[model samples]
Target: MTTEHTGTPRPSDAELARIAAELRALGEPEFDAELEATPVASLVRELAVPTAFALAFGPTDSALPAGAADPAGAGGLLDVAPLTELDRARVWRKIVARRSGGAAQHHGPRAPSWRATWVAVATAAGLALVPVLSTPDRAATPAGRAAAEALGSQARAALEGVPGEQDGGRAAELAAQYSARLSSSGSEAPR
Candidate 1:
């Protein structure tokens, strides 16, 4: 893919270098002084690692030969050229491309839809509960007994204050029936 620039032309390398020199000349005095005072060895120790990674899995090898070459090229400061306008532009373009192209292609497996995810979760729950429900004597389990007791108490509480048309013992009869069923099976009675 190509990005065609339609805005103002990018600055040339010489112009970028001149501007960088001017900015350096106008540097913050305190910060520049502090940086100058910081020893190179201390700065190297602090900035040796670009990331928070540490060697974890490999065997220990602290001792190296007297004149072993630095394979990682971390012996001293690298001789690097100043960044030009083109470098800055390229970096900006990369960042923009990453942000815009995030949704353009699927990197891995496509995610399931919300509805499909819910359906899958419900199916798994139902399957998991099948054996528990099918147990012949559910009240035999401690969890089932606890559930039955909780249900019976809730039913009695619900029937406490409702007004009835007559003095019929309907509420008492319902509560008794629910208690009996719970004592027997720890499950709701069939409709």
Candidate 2:
């Protein structure tokens, strides 16, 4: 089945593979099938997947060969300016900085409002009380103990009564009995 994209025609698998190999030699790897199926322009807008893959497979310094163009000239597939080692390094640094900055922003300290502090205290107290609340009632009444013992006995008896055979012998016997009953009732069971 063919995937449809607006703006440009999709490249054949062979062409994509060839371009992917060239990009790989340059340090970028081929896009996974999922990414390849995405419209080229949309892929470029996301930036991370294509940029990372290009950096992995495409040359760091020289302009990408003309053969490297995807049938759809979505900007992600081609770079007019060849990337140098320095350029690649810069890109790597920026990527790292963006990631770290995001993390730092997420983790940065903030003033705890009174409501937040109260919530935190309440959560802590609730967590601390869990063990006390969850502790089983060890001192059962004599009647309760007797009832529990009776229930346990019934469970054990039920388990013991169940057949544990894995072979179809029991099933076959049951089926035969069912068939016999059906025949006696003058009805044919479905095969």
Candidate 3:
């Protein structure tokens, strides 16, 4: 059975011309005499392809060859312009601009956020560890000495009655052994 026509309103002549212009802007590389005569040229206007979608497909032309069918007198409907190097460049520029709000052109490559974060973290870590990793023999300032004393006091408070209160002698023995090892290894741990 033949399918019934829905009689959907076709795109207006202006709309068709605009579509043709868009196709011309994005068509293939060249629209020579021989290429236009091919079925591909007619198919393009009939299809009303958008520039970005078919830009890679190469150029086409709407110029009907000798004895070609002239169903509609609208020249724009048959017109498929060829894409020149400059035209291709322009289309590409438009595409890129559309995608990135033209920022890619003004700004080159961007440093990744994670890389910047890592750099900041590394700098902070280096600064924080500098004092602890300084040469041990250097004389401490009053503030430095006070800070060191406070840290030592905190450590003593934490370990005040460590293994002594925990178990009879096992923890004390372990602590004693650990202390002896620390005293034996004279070089301070690296930062």
Better of 1 and 3 by TM-score: 1
**lDDT order of candidates, top first:** 2, 3, 1
Best by TM-score: 2
Report the poorest 10 consecutive residues by lDDT, candidate 2.
40-49
Q: State TM-scores per candidate.
A: 0.20, 0.23, 0.18
Q: List candidate 1 segments past 4 Å from native.
A: 1-109, 113-118, 138-191
Model 2 over residues 1-191: C-alpha lDDT tens digits? 12224434444422333333333334322233332343332323222223544454454432234334334444444432233455445434543454454335444342335457889999999999999999998999999999999999999999889976535987888888888898788767546
Per-residue lDDT value at 180 in model 1 = 86
The CA lDDT at 70 in model 2 is: 37
Q: Write the per-residue lDDT of candidate 1 for residues 34-95, one digit (tens) a residue.
A: 32332221222112221111122121122122233234323332322334455656533533
User: Candidates 1 and 3: which is better by lDDT?
Assistant: 3
Question: Candidate 3, residue 188: CA error in Å?
Answer: 51
Stretches off by above 4 angstroms in model 3 are 1-77, 102-191
